[model samples]
Target chain A: MTDIIVGILAFLGTIFVFLAAVGMVRMPDTYLRISVTTKAATLGIGLLLIAGAIYSNELAITAKILAIILFLLLTAPVSAHLIGRTSYFSGVKLWKNSVMDDMEGKYDTSSEELRSGFETDPEKSKPTKSSG
Target chain B: MVDRIIALDLIITTGIGFISAYSILYDQPALLDVAMILALIAFLGTVAFTYYIQQKNKQ
Candidate 1:
């Protein structure tokens, strides 16, 4: 029974990881590709890791598997964010076919004061007309 | 940048593929676990990085 279960999980995991690769290549944009691949890989690997843990029946190994799962969940988004933000700053062009400009609209017309979040709080930043 | 990242992915995947192949051949569950996890991590990290670069490019 355990062997069957392990085989099923391993097979499922392989399919998922393979899908991630396909998505990475097939998607037109970076974010979309990343989303597909990252999400798939996480679930796939997590399952496979757990399968391995179950097979090993070792508490330590299972814990490590769980740790890796948790770690992946936490860092995946952050790294993707970094890459996207950096690409934008360094001037990677947006997909011409993209319909919206959610990130750009904010920066396009934004003045320095607006950008700094002090547009309505000049008094708070002033040395005070009474003092300076 | 994609080139650099792809190069890295290829290298890591090659290394990991070797390790995974070894585990499968030798029937080492522990080694298999390690390979599977590392491969997953690399796959995710690269995909994520690619997204970020794209997002940044958009910005």
Candidate 2:
């Protein structure tokens, strides 16, 4: 029974990993590709780790597997965020068909800073400057 | 973009780690140490790469 279960988990994990690879290749742009692969590949490996723990059924091995999973879950999203931020700042163009871009006009390329998009009232600005 | 690439690299590393761990399970249990080391390397590699990219962008 354990063998069968392990085999099933391993198979599913391989399939998800394969799909992630395909998504990486097929996605239109860097951001889309990153989004797809990050989620899929992480899940794939997580499943594989679970399978490994079950197969071994030993305390040490299971503990190690859990640690790996924890590390992965913590780091994957952070790395993805940093990568996306870097790419955006570095001027990677969005897909032509992208529906919305909140960052548009808000990012200052020269300073590499994101600007607030909210409209500032001229009266408030004048009053603040005069008071100061 | 760099993040995605980093993630892809990590995913590949993880797959390799899985393979190594399976070998340890079936073949030489002594190779368990190899799997552990690989996990450490993968974690450190991601951190180092992210730092490199950030530093490069700052300049």
Candidate 3:
């Protein structure tokens, strides 16, 4: 019974990990790619870990697994958000097919205050203004 | 979209953890050792990567 269960888990974990790799490499945008790779990979290794924990029944190992799970749960989304937001501000264009930037239009362009203040520093603008 | 996927991953990981604990309590010492290592590695990867992800965001 135990062997059967372990075999099944190992098989599933391998498959999921494979998909994660494929998705990471093949996805169109960095944001989408990271999202897929992280979530899928997280699940795959998590299963593998659980398999190990069950086989050993060590309390320390179980505790470690719990910690990992907690950390992943807390952080993956924030990472993806930061990366996506940074990439956007850095001028990596979103996919043309992207329909809605929910964060969009909320940025009222007419407001100079919307600009990151450091970007328009007197010294830097002086050069561009002088050139013009 | 990613939120749903992450939620799903959390569920599966938790379930797998329970299953692993069950296996450990049983007689599969080999499986138990493997599970423990896998658990450690997974936790470490998530924690490390979470930091990596967060740092990437900060930059």
Question: What's the C-alpha lDDT at position A123 in model 1?
Answer: 52
Q: What TM-score does chain A of model 3 get?
A: 0.71
**DockQ scores for all predicted structures:** 0.18, 0.38, 0.12
lDDT of 1: 0.58
The best candidate by TM-score is 2
* lDDT pick, better of 1 and 2: 2
User: Which DockQ-derived CAPRI band holds candidate 3?
Assistant: incorrect
**Model 1 chain B worst lDDT run, 10 consecutive residues:** B16-25
**Clash totals for all models, in order?**
10, 1, 15
- Residues B5-40 of candidate 2 have per-residue lDDT tens digits of 655564655565467447535844445556556656
TM-score of predicted chain B versus true chain B for each candidate: 0.73, 0.65, 0.52
Worst 10 residues of 2 chain B by lDDT: B27-36
Q: Which parts of model 1 are misplaced by more than 4 Å?
A: A108-132, B2-59
Give the per-residue lDDT digits (tens) of candidate 2, residues A1-132.
998898888788777788877887788887897787778877887777788878888898788778767876876787677677767767777888999877776665555555454548553222111100
- Candidate 2 runs further than 4 Å off: A119-132, B1-4, B7-11, B17-21, B24-36
Interface RMSD of 2: 2.9
